[model samples]
Target: MSSIGGFLAAGLIGAYKYRTRGTMSTSVFLMQLRVAAQGTVVGCLTIGLAYSMAKEYLFDKAPKENAKSLTN
Candidate 1:
């Protein structure tokens, strides 16, 4: 998901920049690639952290709840 988001963002930004510059070159393409790579790393870390926190919050107490219900 993060990679997909980054790719889409990079494509949009690159296209806008290229259009404004009125030229397309290898350097521009490379720059966009770099941007996409960096974005992907950042996005993945952010999304992963959020997922971990959410999972912990949603399920961290399930075991204790189950144990209590069994005793009752």
Candidate 2:
């Protein structure tokens, strides 16, 4: 969700910049989209990996009783 938001924001910003410059091209727009897509993929992957690591670490260190409490 956040990655999508970031991508949209980037694209919008890029478009705005191009419009302000009074010169817009398909190539430039496509380039912005490509960059946005790459950023979204990297951001999502990084977030997923970080969340997984943190979850595993927390669960591993949690007491059995405390872990059981989560099921309730």
Clashes in each model (backbone N, CA, C under 3 Å)?
0, 0
For model 1, residues 1-72, the per-residue Cα lDDT tens digits are 966876798689866766676565868767876887788788878999999998899767665553454454
TM-score of each: 0.47, 0.52
| Predicted candidate 2 versus true structure: per-residue lDDT over 4-65, tens digit per residue | 78768877887777677556677876787688778878887999999999888865775566
> Runs in model 1 with CA error above 4 Å?
1-23, 62-72
Clashing pairs in model 2?
none
The lowest-lDDT stretch of 10 consecutive residues in candidate 2 is: 63-72
